[model samples]
Target: MTMINPAGIPHGYNTPIPSEILTADRVETRIGTLEFTDGFPSDDTAAKVFDHLDFLRAVEVFLQCVPAASMEGLRAGLLDIGCDAAHKMVIADRLLDSNPLFLTGNTDTVYALAMLDLHRDGPTVVQIPPGCGPGTVNDAWFRFVTDMGAPGPDRGAGGNYLIVPPEYEGEIPDGYFVSHSPSYTNLLALRGFVVEGKTDVAKAMFEDGVKIYPLSAADARPEMEFSSFSGKEFNTIHANDRTFYNEMADVIRREPIDVIDPETRGLLASIGIRKDRAFAPDEQMCGTLADAAAVGNATARSIVFQTRDKRAYFYEDRKWKTGFVGGDYRWLDGDGRDGRNMDARTMFFYQATLNTPAMALEMVGVGSQYALTERDASGAFLQGSHSYRLTLPSGVPAKDFWSVIVYDPQTRSELQTGQPLPSRSSENNRTELVYNDDGSIDLTFSPEPPSEHRGNWIQTVPSKSWYAILRLYGPLKPWFDKTWKPHDIERI
Candidate 1:
């Protein structure tokens, strides 16, 4: 007996099994009736199926590109605030005011942010104030352009910076530090530190030192307009819904065709988002795009909150964590192979906007440091309704200032409670904060301010859940050496 396949191919030197015989008979019968076609099985239907699959592949690519798109939306939102490219916004009052449109906002330092529209303007000039710490100029795609402040090219002494747009080959002027941007739009964000929490003085320094204008109108440039976004409510985060695709499409139309890689542009082209062309997707395509956006948004959120990387945690026994999982600014995994680290890119852009080498640089005396924690000391998610306390040991490591800011888990922005910015700081302005005899500071987080130490408490909303970040401006050696550590948020 022999075993045979459906095609009647015999299995050597054996009696044919019943199952094999049935399979061979079925295959033989099917083959006898089989009809061969030159192309698709049905009239053009197979081609349509392939086309649909290609569309899905394009969607996945677009999903991976969400961070770039998100950066563009943020640029647009910033521009919308001032409604003018020449004008920029700055925080005026020392008091932390209303919610900022930007995500993972810090109530620690005074900020002066501007959205530059260089698509039609050609080039823009920005002047930074001397003594300002680390700040960044990021393109619309959130890619780092350059650094400003002490660790930056200016070396803590502020100077004029010329930001030339993409493909600009005009006259190269001398006397100004130059940085060429890859996108038509860029975010020029600066942080001003107040000594001993004198916010008014810091705000004044920024007002007098900072200026922005196009190179063409250098002499006749309008005075830099300063608007106070503090103590006011506004949104700066880009929508993560289907409209996010539209934002990306807008970026495509405005930016140079070569700004992004040809591969990504081709993916957008496949979905009818070519430069200068109307991106009017048909009903069927729109439905697919919406579904893709939903999945992309969810994927980004999961990456930020429930990160798979164990490296996100800093201590083995404690729950203290870092937002940058891999620890490297570039998010490289020791082996720098792939393009940019996509997971790191997604996590940063999803929560915050700026990018710079200074962010990862362990500057001993001058620069910023950050620690983020989502879970309590017991490895449980933080809830606003529950009271928690964190203790910062004396010699807090921040030479300039330090702050603890609570944020909404969903928005990743400042947690909006009765207080515009739910934070406590060690600045001189926060003179009310009480410290222990040993010099350690205790911080309380709860829906209601703690009974005895109201000044040491940060308020949280009752029904909402939140996370918090500890920002150290002008970080010191103890921070880098890990000699000084902050206790985890302990539920009380």
Candidate 2:
């Protein structure tokens, strides 16, 4: 049959138009059917597509802005603990244990942390104590600002460092390592290594030598007060629900306009989360946002627990995976040839905190290295009900030390059990670990007591799932060269 157009040209006098270029009267998709009239979508179809588009943007927003939301959550947690000012520091005086809900925090180092607001204080001065381990400053979006101690310009001798805001054009002062940050709020974190399996020396070093104050009051700085958050029950993990969007929105409002790129700004704006306007979504939008959050959370969890990317694995046959995929701190693919590695960024930020170049491209025998595994040798999720054993080869390949920590799959924080620390460290020993005859170490995990190697057993809660991370402080050449491999956790 021939169809007549409004223009009245005789059947368009041309070859038959391909149906691909035209909208059909009815089309079916994952979101049901869409109806159209002469290439124009029906009202119902338009509504469906609009709702679906919002859902997609929200999910992507959750993935891309996790770094920002996580940072905000940390800030709020610290504020609740009275570490509100730069002068007030939260120090893990007894070493970080399972009590505090910190993301992937190990039980190996004494941590001293302070939150800095560049907006309130134009520039801040941080005095790192000598013998400080890895110290980092991350900006509002969790981007690296600077390193202060061992991996920093100070080279472990400790030095005074100045951190300035993005727009600060103040007079540059000499005799201090200075770095400018693009965001208003920054996280100042310093780790103090345990000296000979005790935290007293590291705690004293941080309490007596470390100082932080606004650059304006260089003459007279406020007295630094340390609060021990070691055994405290606190939460720093971001929400996986719709409340996550609010956290991101708060960060956007507090930070500068250019803190995020235009594309990201537009994405957030589409979801009624702009920096300038109130994020008051309508009832319908609210429901959509909730659904989006659930799906986004599931997607992120999948990326962390069962990543499909081959690059995430450390070896061809090993389940040990590096969280910092692509070995680029910036998440650039193909060395920036292919844009950002979205999966890599989502994987790292979802499970960890404190992003810096040292996390990725550290030299051998310098920075730390980590390998995470949630699966057994048979490729099943690590279940708390079952018993498992992980054996490390004789030469563990850590110049400074090595440790393994268990974490709750739900919170991505330390797993809480009868043990307070939930880890076995070679140097920062919370408990003794029995070594094999050939110097190999066998670590056990189970809900019940293991018959032997009780000292090496890290308890797991029944009916709960968990994962483990192997940390190598001062990683040596064997680690980088892949000569020393970790055995997969085998079900016993």
Top-lDDT structure, candidate number:
2
Q: After superposition, how far is residue 371 of candidate 1 from its true place, in Å?
A: 1.2
Q: Residue by residue across 397-441, what tens digits does model 1's lDDT show?
A: 988788888888788888888876688888743677999999998
Q: How many pairs of residues collide in each model?
A: 11, 0
> What TM-score would every model get versus the actual structure?
0.87, 0.96
Worst 10 residues of 1 by lDDT: 22-31
In the predicted model 2, the residue pairs found to clash are none
RMSD of each: 5.7, 2.3
lDDT of each: 0.76, 0.90
> In model 1, which runs have C-alpha deviations exceeding 4 angstroms?
1-63, 87-89, 92-96
Error of 2 at 260 (Å): 0.7
